[model samples]
Target chain A: MRDTYQEQLDELASSLAGMCDDVARAMRNATRSLLDADLQLAEQVISEDMKIDDVRASAEHQAFGLLALQAPVATDLRVVIAAIHGAGDIERMGDLALHVAQAARRRHPQSVVPDEIKPYFTEMGTVGVALAEKAGRVIRSRDLEAAVELEADDDAMDDLHKHMFTVLMDSNWTHGVSAAVDVALLARFYERYADHAVAVARRIVYVVTGQMPGPLAV
Target chain B: MRDTYQEQLDELASSLAGMCDDVARAMRNATRSLLDADLQLAEQVISEDMKIDDVRASAEHQAFGLLALQAPVATDLRVVIAAIHGAGDIERMGDLALHVAQAARRRHPQSVVPDEIKPYFTEMGTVGVALAEKAGRVIRSRDLEAAVELEADDDAMDDLHKHMFTVLMDSNWTHGVSAAVDVALLARFYERYADHAVAVARRIVYVVTGQMPGPLAV
Candidate 1:
């Protein structure tokens, strides 16, 4: 019985890692749709988001089952609890990706990134996906070192977000208000996506360190 | 022993309600600061946000402690777990309130919402605070009827959000890009604040009804 319970805990961790992988895939496709203005790809990313949601639901169900049946104690309990919340963070990351895809779909054929801000968003998309993949690795391994490093990885996205604002505020901002609004919202979606990734890493850190959740991510 | 555990559960619920009250106050003050350009009020709101964070911390700490001490099963376990996530949502709502105030402070003497959008934001602010207050009552009472009503209350904010966007997209939009950006972000802050309030209600319903969280709030 004890071995079975331990196996269930392992299963929960793998399930969470699987959810993170789905989010990473969504982020990649969202950035692709944005960069390429491919409405079809955008739709694919949007439709695939339900898969992530389903994974989250199952992961949570498993976590709750463990809590109820195994009545996990100490570190065991913390892992189950953290996985539940961490899966939630990853699921929301997918939703943010869907929002990014929807943005691409809304202005189909007209890329959300205008000529001037294209490179900035391209870099943000790249960084967002990379960070998400890193988050996935950290989720599965509970690599405390990499988990701690995730915050620094997020700094690139933060810098890009600020740079996007700088471009917006620049007097040379030739993009019309409409484009500016799109970029602003898009930058926020990516920035928030990165923040949630870091939040997931923080959750892992909490589980590993047996500490409370760190300061709320910005 | 059972009585002590029950009292501890009650304490957690009351603590969450306290955090909700604090968030509501922050939303009201944030709106006031934006409309009035009262730097002092904005500063006060910003500084007071930490208090909400502290409340969330203690609330989560209590939840974690209860989980470990009581080893609560089924409904008892769910309540403890939901409180952990619910406190997290409430804390983020406080952060959103701070962002609203920070927007006000960023402009200092100048209000974030321009004259044209003032009425819209005014309506949003009213709706935001009302929903938050309703969220508080729902948290404490777990009033299923009122909880269901909260969704309709959020619809008002959503309409206002869309109306604000229509104004932004109007061809005759005379507000320069800078002002338009400010108004766009401010509108979103209010809209998101309303969404979080409804999310909080959904969480309480989850606890009471044994339902998993409903469809994503946004």
Candidate 2:
């Protein structure tokens, strides 16, 4: 019975890890759509959001079912709880992508984003991908070290977000008020996306170390 | 042994409920400081933030220890997990209050908020207080129905937030780029505070019903 329960838990973990990968892909593609003003890709992200939502629902159901059936204790309970929280974070990540895509669609032809802001978006995308990958690694291997490192990567995204705001405030940009709002919203979305990813990493840490990491300490 | 475990779980729940009450009070006080432009009150919020953080940490630790030691299953496990997530949301609520307090300090003697916007600010404060209060009640009673109502209240906040943006963009408020940015940031903060409150309510729903409410379905 224990072996079967463990196998079921492992299967749930694999499914959740896959969902995280899809969410990360959607985020990256959404960012690309924004920078490139690709409406098709943006629409694709909007459509794919339902799939991410479904995956999140399934993962949540599985976690709860495992807890009920296995009556897991200690470490197993921690893993199940972490999976539930992580699934929520991943679902939100998909929602953020949808937000970006919607914004991209609104700014269609003239892309509110200027050439100079590309690097910030690029860095955000890279950090997002890294965070998602690290979350998957932690889920698979229960690697506390990898989870800690992912938290550190989130700091880099924060720095980049600050820099992006500075750029928005710079007098050089002549796109006017609407553009500024767009950039601010976009920056906020990316920063929040990174925040959720860090939260997932933190959950992983909690699962392995049995304690929540301090914000400043991380 | 089961009785001891149940008693420990009850203690943890009581502690968490107390922490939620403190957080709710902090949120109300912070919004009051913003609406009244009270620097002293704002400073009070800043100082109280530390206490909220400490309470949050202690509550989380207690919950973690309960799970680790008792190894609760089924509904008990769900309750502990919900408490941890609720504590996190409450901590963020305290943080949001700090954000409003900082903004109040930045405004100084001359309130950036014009008299015409007073009604909107009043409404926001009312909604914020209501939401915080509802969160506290949910924590105490585990009342899923009240939580659902709080989720509906968030839609009212969303409408107010949208209205504020519309007002800012209108030709009437000719307050240059800086004022526009300030209003935008302030609106974002209030919207986000409401969002977090809604999240707390949603967790309550999950704890009771074992399902997430559909987004915008409120």
Candidate 3:
């Protein structure tokens, strides 16, 4: 009986890791769709988002099952609880990615990002993709060193977000208000995506060390 | 033992409702502070957010306790899990409120919102405060009628958000990029605050009717 329960616990961990992998793919594809203006790719990312949502739902369903049946306690219990929250953060990250894809789709063929801001978004996309990948590794390996580095990694995204605002605030900014709104919201999408990545990393750290990760590193 | 567990569940419900009250007040005060540019009120909102955070923490702590101790199952287990998610949504609402207060504090004396867009924000603030209060009632009373009204109410906020973009996109927008950024972000804060409230209402509906609320209608 104990062995069966242990296998179920292992199953939960693997499912969570699987969800993280989907999150990584979604972020990468969404960013590519936005930057490359590939409508087919954008459509793919948008459609596949339902799969990501399913992964989230299944993880939560499994969690609820574990709570009801096996009745996990102590650290086992915290892990289930944290899974509920962490799954949400990851799901929201997927939604953020979809928003990026939708933005690209909404402005199809027009290159929603102006020439002046394209490079910055390319950089932000790269960071978002990298962060999601890193989050996957952290979840899969529970690598303390990798988890520790996630916060500092997020700083680069924040700088990009701030730089975006600076560009919008610049006297020479001529992208017009429509483009400015696009730029602002898009930067926020990436910034928030990174925030969730770091949040998930914190949970991994908590599960491993039983100590909560400290303030988000700049 | 069953009666004791039921009482503990009731206590958890009360704590959640209390947290909702704080969320409502924080939204109301944060909007007032931003709209009125009342620095003192803004400061009050910012400082008091810690209390809101504390309430959320206590609620979650109790939930973890219940999960560990009583090992609640089925609907009881779902309620505890939902409370964890609901508390997070409420805490995030508080953070959204804090963001509004910080925006107000950051632009003290000089209104961040320009004259042309003030009416829109005024409307948004009114709608925001009303939604938060309504969310509080929905959580407390689990009033399905009130819950049913939430999505439509959020539509008002979304309309305000879209209208904000329209104003910004106006060819004649005289306000510089700085004001545009402010309007965009402040509008988002209010919009997101409403989203969380609706999310909480959905959880309430789920708890009362054992059916997940669809698309965030109150």
Candidate 4:
């Protein structure tokens, strides 16, 4: 019985890590669709989001069952509860990617990102995917080191977001208000995607250490 | 022992409701600060956000204690679990308000919303506060009727959000790129604040009905 319980817990963690993988793919494809003006890729990201949501529901159900039947205590209890929260965060990351894809679709046939700003988004998207992948590994291994590194990675995403805003607000900006609004919102989506990844990593640190991770040095 | 356990569960619900109240006030003040360019109010909203975070941590601890000690099952278990999720949603609402407050502070002495766009923000702020207050009532009463109403209320927020985008994209827009970016993000903050409120209400419905709420009619 105890072995079964332990296996169930491990399965729950794997399910959440699977969610991170889905979000990573979604973020990458969403960014591609935006830069390439590929409606098909955008649509695919939007549709596949349901798969991520399904995983979230299943993970939550598993965690609920563990709490109800197995009555896991101590670190085991924290792990189950963290899974519940982590699932929600990862699901939200999927939603953020969906928003990015929808933005790409909205401006289809016309690339939403201009040439100069493309590099910023490319970097942001790269950072977003890396963070999501790291979050998945951290979830499976309970690696505090990797989790802490995710925080620094998130800072890089934030810097990219700020740079995007600076570009929008520059006196020489010629993209006009509509493009500015789109860029502002798109940058926000990628930044928020990174934030959720960090949130999932922090949850793992909490589960392992039984304490919230403290602030990282710069 | 059962009586004490029941009381703890009730206390958890109350704590969550109290979080709603804090968020409501924060949203209201944040909006006021933005519309009025009141730096002091904006600072207050920013500082008070910590109080809401404190409530979230305490509520989660309370739920965790109940899960570990009482080992609640079925409806009781759902309530405890829902408290964890609902607390997170409510805390996010508070954070959204904080974002609004920060925006107002960043542009202090210069009103972020121009004359023509003020009406949209005013209505969005009103809607945000109403949703937060209603979410509190739904948490305490578990009123499915009230919970459903929040969905509609959130629709109003979305409409306002869409309209703000339209206004920003309009050919007549003269606010320039910087102001457009501010309005875009501020409108998003209010819309998301309402979204979190709807999320909390849905959690209550799930606790009561043991199922997720269905999509609301347009």
iRMS per model, in Å, is 1.4, 3.5, 3.2, 3.4
Which prediction has more favorable TM-score, 1 or 3?
1
- TM-scores of chain A in all candidate models: 0.96, 0.94, 0.94, 0.97
> Per-residue CA lDDT of candidate 2, range A1-218, in tens?
87889898898889878977898899889989999999999999999999988888788778767865666767787788788778878888888888988988987976858777777887888888778777877778877888888867888988988787777667775656656667777887888887887788888788788777886421
Q: What is the C-alpha RMSD of each candidate to the true structure, in Å?
A: 1.3, 3.0, 2.1, 1.7
**Lowest-sum lDDT 10-residue window in model 3 chain A:** A209-218
Mind giving the per-residue lDDT tens digits that candidate 1 earns over B38-79? 999999999999899899889978987887778788778878
Over 4 Å off, model 3 = A215-218, B1-3, B215-218
lDDT (10s digit) by residue, model 4, range A182-218? 9999999998889899999999899989998763221
TM-scores for every predicted model: 0.97, 0.88, 0.95, 0.98
Candidate 1: clashing pairs of residues: none
Off by over 4 Å in 2: A171-173, A216-218, B1-10, B68-74, B105-118, B216-218
Q: Show the colliding residue pairs in model 4.
A: none
- TM-score: which candidate is best? 4
Model 2: per-residue Cα lDDT at residue B44: 90
Q: After superposition, how far is residue B180 of candidate 1 from its true place, in Å?
A: 1.5
Model 3 agreement with the true structure over A1-68: per-residue lDDT tens digits: 88987777667767777777787788788878877888998999888888878788888888888899
* Residue pairs with clashing backbones, model 2: none
Clashes of each: 0, 0, 2, 0
Going through the candidates in order, their DockQ values are 0.66, 0.35, 0.60, 0.63
